[model samples]
Target: MNSDPDRQVPFLSYGFRPFFLFAGLYAVLAIAAWTGWLALHDMPGVWITPTFAGPPQQWHAHEMIFGFGMAVVSGFMLTAVPSWTGARRIAGTPLLLLALLWLAGRAAIWFSAFLPPIVVAIADLAHLPVLAVMVLGGLMVRPAPRNLVFFVFLALLTVANVMIHAEWWDFTSDTASPALDAAVLLLALMVAIIGGRVVPAFTRNVLVMRGPSTALPRSFAWLDRVSLASLAILAGLAAAQIEGPPTALVAGVAAAGHLGRLSFWRGMATGGAPILWSLHLAYLFLGLGLAALALAHATGMLAVSAALHLLAIGAIGGMTLAMMTRAALGHTGRPLRVVRPIAGAYALVALAALVRALGVDLLPGHYMAVIYVAGILWVAGFGIFSAVYAPILVGPPLPKNPPSA
Candidate 1:
């Protein structure tokens, strides 16, 4: 339970260090690779074969959700659970092993075309169960219902992942797309749940420190409950592959509930702080994405892929980067302020989401161009994060006190 940083090998000292650092790097690398794949796929005489198993598009989708997304989730959960349960932190050797397992999964997926499908599946599937067990053990110490719910989230994510691999194993051809949808929804739910807790709380902390403030962000209320419940329902429907009016209805309700929930958080008041406003922006995407999704199903105006991109690029990407920056800084005993590059990174990611989600519709004549631009923005955003935060993550924490100024 000690809060002190382990100095011998700072990178392996805690879960957040290695996971967050690598997640940022992988975000840049993966997106760049995906972009490259897209650009070269159609060119004459350009025989760019994929290094990853499966189709390029499938690899892109899978890695973003399970690879990049899960890495951030792992980092956050591993770092936070100890504080939540007052249990021993997973540091040193155990942390390294867990991180290595995640890296191995990425490698297995990348080279899956050459490897045995069963071996690839086993390697890629191993990380989540181990992570779930580690998290469950910690939650069991305190056993609060609220905290224990995350264990359920982890378990569901594992199931969703298996569904994706089922196609590779030739068990089912139709499962991967729906399973990926379910996975995205699950991640969006995590964002909703976690952001619900932190955004308003962090905003209120900043507001309180600033001076007297009568209108504080609201606490967990009926709207929050409704938002989460509706989203959970939609996620279940996606997993079940239920389509038509029912899915649209639930998505509409979820959209309304989430946007309504956000209104109570007083996001407008946090405009002065990039660290806080970035979160608010990310939550906004969650609501907007659901709305787009509902419209896509109901009116057939928007592509479902477009809507999911909003959730993927904006909600998941934005929120994770925002949280990673804040946590990395705070845990390293540095200021909570976002430097200019990191703040620009935040803006680039939001812009990337907007472009990716809406650009084709807005500029129907230039579909490939839109994709390329969005990919560039995504790479730049996370590239900045990886470059800027690498030292902070790998280096020792700042001293608590120093000689007099």
Candidate 2:
């Protein structure tokens, strides 16, 4: 829109622009496809056979975590590393290529029935390492110990992904399920780590600006360290397929630690701010979800699927949407406040998580109905995001000094 000859194409100008857009759209479409395939699977005369590398459920899990989840992670890392280290941003051709690599992985997985397993594995596995190299380049510019740990996260994620693909390649028969669990835990850990840093910082900034604040967010405290450490241990146990009392103990400790850590943040005081409260709510889910997971392991009161949906849909989905909306706004030079529709989108996702996680358990007779409701809510939330943010992301940034009102 600016028509400046020297400006990069607006969508390719920053990592967040295209990748966030893709993440939003893919979140909607992928879930929709999964739900549709599921609903039509038993219907007579239905012609909806979708071929995937694995079972439909595995394909759903894989794409949501590896495909959709990684896109958001990639976008955030690519955008943040430059900011954190004063390095040049990955943009233009390199960024475009990176985006295409992610898309290719999705395509190869969706149509893997027609493709060689080796080809599918290679195509899918290539994106993360290239992303790691790009992120490492920027981290090397400054190289703080705190920042460099993310490279390790990327490496672990790659290993988890490989574990999943190994099953497809006949390297192992039973690794995919546990590996998927590991991947989810790793992503949750990232959310916990990043959320710990930003949620309080942003909340404090808003609180201070609004008025003098008696209580501000307490971060990087003893409890925070305990929380992260416990979650990391849980992730390790998951990767190794450990079960029973030990995993339950760690998960329970992690749950208490995170919830306790959250209480120090003063989330309730951020009244009427969707951008702020959505984050708090997502963190709340992270804590509660872990608690549920611990219960699932220790007592036979909850289904594992319910606990996982709480983590995957509630914490991961809600946090990513909140961060994506907030980041897209700030980086694009738009106001940091969220519009009403986006606010409703936040509520929709939270409700979707609750319904998906607990609905069937509550009303066992309506299992399929509950699934349909949850999927629709999930789709609608991201549909709103994609529609609202498309123009903002693709358009040139607002002029720093606009014409006087």
Task: Please name the candidate that would achieve the greatest lDDT relative to the true structure.
Answer: 2
lDDT of each: 0.91, 0.91
Candidate 1 structure quality by residue, lDDT tens digits, 1-405 = 233445447887778999999899999989998888888985788988676677577779999988999999999999899889987778877777788899999999999989999989999999999999999998888989888889999999999889888987888888888888999999999999999989989988888877784588886577888889999999999989998789899999999999988888889988778999999999999999999999998988999899999999999999999999999999989989999999999999999999999999999999989999999999999999999999999998888895688
Query: Candidate 1 lDDT (Cα, whole model)?
Result: 0.91
Runs with alpha carbons beyond 4 Å of true place in candidate 2: 1-6, 45-47
Give per-residue CA lDDT, model 2, range 1-405, as digits (tens).
332223679888889998999999999989999888888986788877578867678889999999999999999999999999988888888888899999999999999988999999999999999999999999999999889989999999999899889998889999998999988999999999999999999999888876664677886578888999999999999889898788889999999999998998989987689999999999999999999899988986888779889999999999999999999999978899999999999999999999999998998999999999999999999999999999988899898899998
Q: After superposition, how far is residue 315 of candidate 2 from its true place, in Å?
A: 0.6
**Alpha-carbon runs more than 4 Å astray in model 1:** 1-8
Error of 1 at 388 (Å): 0.7
Against the true structure, what is each candidate's TM-score? 0.97, 0.97
Error of 1 at 18 (Å): 0.3
- After TM-score superposition, the amount by which residue 371's alpha carbon in candidate 1 deviates from its true location, in angstroms, is 0.8
